[model samples]
Target: MKLNERSVAHYATSDSPADHTGFLRLWGGLGTPPTAGGAGRRCWFVLKGNLLFSFESPEGRAPLSLVVLEGCTVELAEAPVPEEFAFAIRFDAPGVRPYLLAADGPAAQEAWVKVLSRASFSYMRLVVRELESQLRDARQSLALHRRSPWKAGATGRSKPQASEHSSRLENGHSPSKDCSPGGSVEGRGSRLSGWASAEWELPGPASLLLGRGQSPVSPETSCFSTLHDWYGQEILELRRRWLQRAQGGRPARENKDRP
Candidate 1:
């Protein structure tokens, strides 16, 4: 957790490993070819909470790199593992190459997978919650805009005209008449309320980011593209629906199938 900076001498001479109080340490190789020098160099991995950190040795005194296990996709290696990699699991980190980690054995591999899965779920939930909160704020803003007095009108003026019902209320119209005072406001309110209640029923942009058919092993890079596309479409659809309702209290026929 400290992540203190250390000099070369400090790294070479010091061997102060973390207590790993709530950490699970697994011995594994970083990778090969690019990391050939560290290959077979028996590194110590400590997974604490949602983060996984590696050390040069088991004590975890020599800090290597740390990875936040959020937005990462995991999958079994499509290619067969070589003899050296009898227990291997692949992870596709965002904006990075697909790195292969060779676990010590089957037990280690399973443990790593379990921890990573939990981390991924936690991360996803956090992202989705944040997105939902943002969406709620956006809906509130849209409602405010709809209720603005400066909304467009045929009178060529920003100030909106009082509805007949509102004028009736102000002039103390007889309640016995067929048209009740404030009827227009009440009817519009009811319609808007119904629409507001249905807002939550629609799938949010974040929920649609990862398609229903997306594989657990799908690359994060591709998922981003899908998410952007889905998000854009959802925004456009929402704007179009809002415009129609504001214009004539009905959805546009062109986008009838969208919602």
Candidate 2:
């Protein structure tokens, strides 16, 4: 049951009441979830199982139903809408979220929003957790080669590590010492760039740059190399843990392969 004053939206699959229209008629702003809150109206229409979840609300507010389906979209035409009812996936989250598809007034909307918000929150956490798992695996693969270059000598790795991009980093390579042009590598990246960033102290971009005498080349080049090497190690370590976990956290697996 939806409210009379407020219009609820949904994917085509949802069971909208006979009085309510299943087809969406929008006025503006939608496609994907906003990276951050922004101005203007934005909405997300999702199809889950047989239910169509049309998630909307003010952007960036508390009780945020900030998580939803990431999918391809179909746009709709603009129409007259309530000023406060505009969908916001921009800079803000929805207010008192998880508003339902029931036919009721403000109270129903409030209850529905809360219910859905909690569900979305849970999902958001899972995604973050999954990321942690993958990163751990990639980091470990990198470390194995780093510690025993001779064993991994058959595997070729020549390029510097991409600080944030683990997929591109070499998993099979010589040890870190062998790759060194000479000296300590200090890698710095914003701790805030990923799931942990929001919860941790992120180093500035300059942290990725070389500091003091830690230079084998020009300051700019040295900084780049140092950052690269530092991040390279981090990548290895993270992947190492991930791989260990995947293999069931066994010490024996750590010693296997590459030779």
Candidate 3:
């Protein structure tokens, strides 16, 4: 494949931080068969984000070879000389011979293997996607935490009104008396008692099912069964109250006896 040799040369000389740079012994000249008996030539290798370049010397401005680290695997290999810390970059393409290289020591050999193995565009993309997902989740959690205080403040504001109504009921006063038309005091008291019994007598089963501080299921869930059951309970409670009023029985006496 044709490469932009001028751009490659410029990048080799650029001040960008190299992923890894060191002297590694090359087993053969680029595009040549390996020699069996010769000690390999040591060259300066620079790895820059999936591109491995070889230079004649550390100060060389030109790149002797460029190996694109894609569709390839780095594996520990036996070198021509015994005890040489050797590794090879083996490509999957047909008729392409593996590039044999030897690091100066065992530590360097392992480091080179690790860096080369991970030096692929696909691997970098995978890591980026994983990080993005984690960041999105973190942002969602922060938003929920931020909204919690506003919900608490709203609940706090409503409490005083509820307390005032409850105190009026306890003091034998009707909460709706101010707006209600004038009538006999006994008649007004009975009407207020009946109104409170129907409206505020029992807490809904949905609130009981969800304990304090727990949010109710969202309407957007499309959970029709739960919604039906909740409303069914409410219908049953209203029906029972209607039957009591029809029979001329007052539930106020029963409610007043409760703790």
Candidate 4:
């Protein structure tokens, strides 16, 4: 219906009657239909539904009588036309043979062709929009159901008890019931690796006992090694004294000879 107004504005002069039920009358020079001998004279054109109608104006009285065209199809002209006529549009319909109609100007021809073509396709557009709306609603319903929690009581089954973690929190106890003296499973790897890394990074003096560097003989090794060796010798000497006391302080050669 909106296309009717556009067609009238572009193709019709100041005086023309138009509506939705009746055909839209556009004044233009009519070319000869395929059955005609030569180019036709100026006339008025109208399109109602799938039919096209042409009317010739009588000299004194209003135009009457109608030539109806059906299975109507409209298209723009491929080549340029004579100057006497503006740009042309070709109409091919079922009952009638194809004919070339000339508009008053090129702009008018373009508007007539575009508006009519779009009008034909508008119904398909509405159907597509309705389908898209239904599809969107279906997806929203599915997602809402998926995100909602299930109601177990609806199945006539008793509800599950709270997990240990939830029970601990409810009773004001820490939620680490399964944790050992060390830590939780998630943190164990990081904790062990951190302790080993810190142990390796101890001061040079502590490296000797930990055996972190190359060898104990390295000159650049910690000076604490000398103290460590002194303590080692003192420990060996005290052990020898204790063993001698256990043996009643007997001389080694005397004991061997007696045995």
Alpha carbon deviation, residue 119, candidate 4 (Å): 4.3
- State every prediction's TM-score relative to the real structure: 0.34, 0.21, 0.56, 0.29
Backbone collision count in every prediction? 0, 42, 0, 0
The order by descending lDDT is 3, 1, 4, 2
Cα RMSDs, all models: 22.4, 19.4, 29.5, 40.0
lDDT of 2 by residue, 1-259 (tens): 3332222232232344321112122333334332333323333434332233444532312221212322211111112433232221211234422121221233333332222222222223334333443554565476565665232432333232243234213222211122121222122111111221211122311122223323223232235576477557546755766676587764664457424
Candidate 1, 33-81: lDDT as tens digits? 4333334444566655555566666564555756555545443332233
- Model 1 local distance difference test score: 0.40
Q: Pick the candidate with the highest lDDT.
A: 3
The number of residue pairs in model 2 that clash at the backbone is 42
Model 4, residue 200: C-alpha shift (Å): 83
What lDDT would each prediction earn against the true structure?
0.40, 0.31, 0.61, 0.35
In candidate 4, which residue ranges exceed 4 Å CA deviation?
Answer: 1-39, 57-73, 78-81, 84-96, 119-259
Preferred candidate (TM-score higher): 1 or 2: 1
Worst 10 residues of 4 by lDDT: 172-181
Worst 10 residues of 2 by lDDT: 70-79
Best candidate, TM-score: 3
Comparison by TM-score, 2 against 3, better one: 3
